[model samples]
Target: MNAKIVDQHVECYVRSLLPEHTGLLKVLEQFAKLHNVPIIHPEIAQYMSVLLEIAKPTRILEIGTAIGYSASVFASHMKRGHIDTIELNAIMAEKARETFEDLNKSVPEVSLSIHLGDAKDVIKTLEGPYDMIFIDAAKGHYQTFFETAYDLLSKNGIIVSDNVLYKGMVATDDYIVKRKITIVKRMRKYLEFITTHPNLETTVLTMGDGLAISYKKGILNE
Candidate 1:
């Protein structure tokens, strides 16, 4: 399965067809690279842009805001939407706030606010029914995130979980390292739960690291 997934060369070729980032986005991408922050790849961002273009969600709930790269991307593409992103690390949250301000200067149609705290705790306090819920935080807590997302998501809404495959380790135990066994195990469980849940319909895409896109079972054609 991993062999069938896009290779580095193919991924690069696909990315070449996408437009180049400019302004703050370019800077954020560079900062993420320098700081070793785990931001989505450009191709993944493009993939998400296409989804947002179609969904046109008015309100988005983001579980992770690692310097706000993905949140800013969500805002920039959503045209008119509000994003509430949670970040546990104070320093990263501050940087994300700064990134939001920078993004606002250009994409003024979108609004973003950073919720600083553990997402598991913070999610409970949020008033939701959000159009979209994006989970990209700690791999071990994805199932918990989905539980919160299930309650918060509106009818016909979508739930997108990133790093679901964890570099394909979740697909097979052969690639799982000692340090990542727990994360891999948890991710596998989360994938199984989401894919098999009667209330949800999920498709795990091989793009980027890996993305699991799910929606309520009855809403696909609606």
Candidate 2:
């Protein structure tokens, strides 16, 4: 009866109907549930997988690596890409390393890289020019992350940001969540700035929580 349960159910049914998951990804998804990792919704995972399959990017940089659920899902579909995923939580990072190692048994082709630290500090040290950048780290840090995202992104790279809607709080009046106002305001500001930024073309899709897909548009301009 709850909205969160409804969302979860819908995502489950959609994943059930999807036709293309290979063996490792299916098992990896199951593991996500058993451990209660709170990876992206299944519909969102499908979106992420489809995008990876289509883009066929050579390199991906993910700012969050929570238990490596999404990272494994992404790896299973990435035929020849390298992934550099970061996690600020040391325990999660260690567990993620184990997950990636376990996945290596069946899905051995992917180059899964791990970075454990605050992304802002780690991003600078990372060898970038990544074709895909997925931001799912701290919510309040989205804007700070976005600023560097543009710089590290390749000429025609893509950026996918998760949870921009903040459980539908951004649209409500200020009194709704007066206590945590700072994050809501910052999220709205980031969304607004990203939508209007000249170098990128972005659309906020409402599939799950909300996904902000931004594509660098310099090639289209030229």
Candidate 3:
């Protein structure tokens, strides 16, 4: 889905200014482009790198494991951390395992576990207190994923939701296609809940389709 949330010129300029991806990340980026696999945008990756650096999370829970690109990126920023990632597609899960194996060789300090199953079911089986939670799976089920995983997050942890704006369709009806109407509506509902929830403070950024970063309020302050 080609959704130009940010201006094309500005996005390109921002990407141009960032450093190139090297090693396995470089290969994965190229492979994703060639195979048409949906991975995090380069700009989003860079933004997350900075956030991860600041958060310095010891445990991360990733809802989507697409070829392990984002998980690998998370591993690189971590000094010594564990990432538990879920993948629904069996083929993609195997591919992620291979990528994790390679990542192990490079960053032995970080460990990764790929859980193959529907996130809705897998999330319930997971234990709590993860330092960070990343949601990047099926768009329509984002609210379901977040609500189920909410208690799994640590007190000060943050939840990052990718593609929340959904190619700009969630923002306005003018950009909505008939086929995407349901998804757009669901996305709008999810955004409203997160933004208005008394327990959370959320900010939706317009970059990279749309990224919503949320953090719990009371417990953290307490």
TM-score of each model, in listed order? 0.94, 0.86, 0.97
Error of 3 at 94 (Å): 0.3
Question: 37-104 in candidate 2: lDDT tens per residue?
Answer: 66786778888888988988878899999888788878877887789998999988998898888888
Per-residue CA lDDT of candidate 1, range 153-191, in tens?
888789999988888788877677788889988899999
Better of 2 and 3 by TM-score: 3
- Among all windows of 10 consecutive residues in model 3, the one with the lowest summed lDDT is 213-222
Q: Indicate which candidate wins on lDDT.
A: 3
Error of 2 at 123 (Å): 0.4
In model 1, the clashing pairs are none
**Candidate order, TM-score descending:** 3, 1, 2
lDDT score, candidate 1: 0.89
- How does candidate 1 fare on TM-score? 0.94
What would the C-alpha RMSD of candidate 2 be, to one decimal place? 3.2
Ranking by lDDT: 3, 1, 2
lDDT of 3 by residue, 193-221 (tens): 99998888899999998999998765544
| Candidate 2 lDDT score relative to the true structure | 0.82
Query: Which clashing pairs does model 3 show?
Result: none
